[model samples]
Target: MPIQQKDPSRASTYSWPGVLAIALGALSLVVTEFLPVGLLPGICRDLGVAEGTAGLAVTATAILGFIAAPVTAIAIGRADRKRVLLGLTALLIISSVLSWKAESFATLLIARVILGIGVGGFWAISITAAAKLVPPEKVHAASSIVFAGISIGSVIAVPAGSYIGAHADWRDGFMGASVLAVVCFALQLVFLPSLKMKHGVNVRDFFGLLKDPKVRAIFLTVIFIVAGQYAGYTFVTPYLEQITHLSTAIVSVLLFAYGVATVVGNFVGGAFAGRNLHNTVVATVWIFVLSLASIAAFATSPMFAGLSLLVWAVSWGMAPVGTQLWLYNATLHAPEAAQAMNTSVFQLSIGLGSLAGGIAVNHAGLHSSMWLGALILALAVMMVYIVGRMNRQPAVAA
Candidate 1:
């Protein structure tokens, strides 16, 4: 069925409720995506698989999510975004239910594969949908609201899932996720307006976006920053356990601190980006470099390690908001396509970071990963600086 367009005049009015619904949807999807991270041990024991084998569940989602983002943008083809979102939420519901009942490793992996599709499509459209829900001037705030869900979900998922798995069954965590998705879907049904696309996006649009040097720079910066972050973060627990000599309990508390810092940074970053996009991006990248260096430098001091971790978390929290806003501003003509590309790069870079960090740890030791990450982010700082210079120049007449 063709998506019917709502009255064009409605576009002028803000839909704060609708934006909130999308935020909830984001929360649901993210929780579902990462729940496995905390429940992996239980899953491995139950399914008679090794830890590395169980880890494939996460790898599957990331790899599929990377593919799904751009493909989803092309596949939707001018469809009503409201329905597309609804369908994706429904997919989440199905995936979560399947996961809740999954008894075999194969069954659980299959469920996660379904989830990857939902994750990709939802993220690809969410920012654009959130932007459209309000007036142009409030786009930054709306995007921030959506990003808040991600930050909160990341904080909530592991601990919550772990708690549930410890107290009950790991599958119960997925059941809770399903319940969340169901609520999100219902809220979206009640709140989301018809969101017809202005034009259908195609593969060519993604390629055309790559031709812009600014866009390429933005993506390169994303890769460097995100991959670097993961490289260090992927092994942070070990570093704390061995080098810092913190107990598991203390490490958990510090991680919670990092989570809280991340949430605060998201809003702070959004507010700053709203005021001045270019400067915000530059400042955040620089802060990211410094924070990573601090963590590595103070590896032997628990107080300093914890402090640097919070700072690092804050800088990372700010990063997505700043880079995303930069991408949106640079690709106003095709924001969705650009966002889809951003999503792909972000997912791929996570895998890259983890792999690189793993290699660095295996060879050079735990501290090496953090230093490598900082070095990678230095490149990102340079890219952001060059991009800032490009933006400052006057446009030549075509």
Candidate 2:
């Protein structure tokens, strides 16, 4: 069934107001989701836990997202997405407040877990709902636009919060996120056009995705791309400082530069993804591999490594999202499930990448880690090719 979209803003040339609203929702999710990563040192000092223990603040949310998103997608079909988004945003408010007051690592972890449920539920349901906010022809654009928010929010918000924590306090990050979540919630309540799914959620719908070849390929691709970049990205500091022998200040500047490059990639990837999602994903994955390999091979070249990191971050930004739109295209019937599943897969990849990076960094030199990443990205690219083959339909050519 095709979607019905009301003409709204210029951004919604193909979408409705709900797509923009969902992007707002995505902004909140990305901030809350990556907040701990930025504030880990502060959280550790405040809670009197080791940084590793404080890191669980992020782990808890990610684990919860993995556990909760799929089921939420199945259970919450065809409901009022505006209500759903508002409810999740309210949960984000509550969770952020809980995180603000948490005194112990365990308490923070509990709060983070609650935060994860809100994020997981929102990601799973919101993108599919955004798709509904646009006409069928414009579904790709709407979905890509919402996903671009995550990339923008992650690269921009996490760093800003980290800067705040460095200057003021870690709790300030949570406080700011709470205020933003409230604003997002209120905006959704006001400006978001109401929408309903084309059909109700069925138990059978979940099982049906299991039989699809495209789902398997997409799942693999997500795990691959995410795990690869995360492996290097999680340990970019060591790569810059130890491998490249750059000073901390210079490394930070380069990292900030890399982030800026990534934001550029997000917009470029979004535009291309709206056209041909599969080809865009494949191209991004390969570029991702080449970028990682270049850094690993030329670690002593700081200028070259910095340039490679820029490309790497940009391409890394592209894959998680570009593939998401690809998954949306593949699982047209269960768009919610596809979106939610991609979140779960990508979240799981974060955990996996971090763990793998830690292990590889400990056992071998940091230089070897990019190879490990490149290996995974290669697999992800392969999955893209295979899935494209699997999902290939007879194209209507001019």
Best by lDDT: 1
lDDT of 2 by residue, 1-398 (tens): 99967433222333455678779888888888777765655675677864434445655677788876876776767676667788888888898888888777777778788888888888887766777666678877987788677767877654565566567888888888888888888878877766555565566766787688767777887888887876666556546666899865576567667767888887788888889887887899889999999998889998888888889988976765677666767688876556666777877777677567656766786776788888888888788888777666535331
In model 1, which residue pairs have backbone atoms overlapping below 3 Å? none
User: Per-residue alpha-carbon lDDT of model 1 for 143-248, expressed as tens digits?
Assistant: 8899788888887775565556557778888889889999999999999988877776799899999999888988999999988887777566557767889865
Score every model by TM-score.
Answer: 0.82, 0.80
What Cα-based lDDT does every candidate model obtain?
0.82, 0.74
**In candidate 2, which residue ranges exceed 4 Å CA deviation?**
1-19, 44-55, 131-145, 193-198, 237-252, 267-283, 296-301, 358-371, 388-398
RMSD, one per candidate, in order: 4.6, 5.0
Q: Which TM-score value belongs to model 1?
A: 0.82
Please give the TM-score that candidate 2 achieves against the real structure: 0.80
